[model samples]
Target: MKKLALYLGLVILMFLTSCSSSKKMSSVMKTYEVETMGVGNDGTYLIKVTDYFRTSDEMVYLDGLKRDAVHCVIYSGIPAGNGSINQPALMNADTKIEGYEQALNEFFEQKEYLNFINSVVNSSKTITRLKDSKEYRISAVISVNKDELRKYLIDKKIIKSLDFIF
Candidate 1:
C-alpha cells in the first residue's frame, strides 16, 4: 500500500511538471504552424513539396534575400495534376527544392533563428492529406537533433563550415 501510494504521487508530479513546462514554453516562443502538401510521381517519391507556414512572423524580403517567415520550394518535375505510377513516397521534408539549400543555410545558421525553428518544429504538429494514400496523419510535436541538422545543412552547402583559421 505504501509503495503504491508513493508511485502514484510520483506519477502525478511528473504529469504536472510536463504540463506546466509545455504551457510555459509555448508562452515564451512565437508559434509557427506548418501544414504540408506535396506532389510527385505517384506521390511515392515526392518531386515537389509545399510547406505552408502559419505564423505571426512578418513574411517579408530584405537585403536581397527572402524573409525568414516561411521557406520557398523548387521541384524536380512538374506536378502532373495527380501522382504518377513511378512509386509511392513518404510525406517528409526530403524533396530537393530550388535554392532551398542556400536558403536553409542562411536561415537556420543563426542561434536565435535556429532556436526559433527548433521551438516551432518541436512544438508544431504534423497533419496529413487524405487524398494521399501513404500519408501517416501524424499530428504531434517532435524534437530534432541540432547537430545533425547543422551537419546536413553544411553538407548540402546550405551553410558555411565551422572550420576557421586564426
Candidate 2:
C-alpha cells in the first residue's frame, strides 16, 4: 500500500513539473506587440515594440527588441496608431514559400536585419518590472528603412519584387 502511494505521489509531481515547463516554453515563444509610432523621412517607418525577457542586460534587451521590431515588420504588420496608417506585412505569413525559412533564419542569425534599422531612440526606452517574476517588459521606438529592407528581401529572393505583378 505504501509503495502504491509513493508511485502515485511521484506521478503527480511529474505532471506538475511538466505543466510548469510547458508554461515557460509558451512564454518564450510568445510574440511581442508592435505598433506604429509615426513615419520617418526617406521611406522609413517609426515603430514601437514591446517585449518581455528574463535578462536584465541592457544590450541583450535592446537587441531582442530591435529584432522583434524587424520581425513584426516583415511577418506581422505594424498596427495603425499614433497618427500613422496601418502598414501591411512585407511577407504574407500564411503563404508557404520554399527556402524562405532558411533565408529568414540566416537573415536574423547573421544579424542582417541591423542594416535596415536607422536608429533606436535610447531616450524613448522604457522598462517595467513584472510583479512576482524576473521578467522585465521593455519597450522602445525604432526607425526602420522600409524601402531598403524590401529591396534587400527582393534581391535575396526571399520576397517577390514589386515589378513581379506587372
**Top candidate (TM-score):** 2
Name the candidate that leads on lDDT: 2
User: Candidate 1: where is the Cα deviation over 4 Å?
Assistant: 23-47, 51-166
* lDDT tens per residue, model 2, 16-57: 999888643312354698878877887888988899989879
Candidate 2: list runs displaced more than 4 Å: 1-30, 93-97
TM-score of each: 0.23, 0.79
For model 1, which pairs clash? 42-84, 44-88, 44-89, 74-98, 105-158
Model 2: residue 117 alpha-carbon error in angstroms: 0.8
Tens digits of per-residue lDDT, candidate 1, 57-117, equal: 3231111011122221111122233333332111124433356544644554543233322
Error of 1 at 1 (Å): 0.6
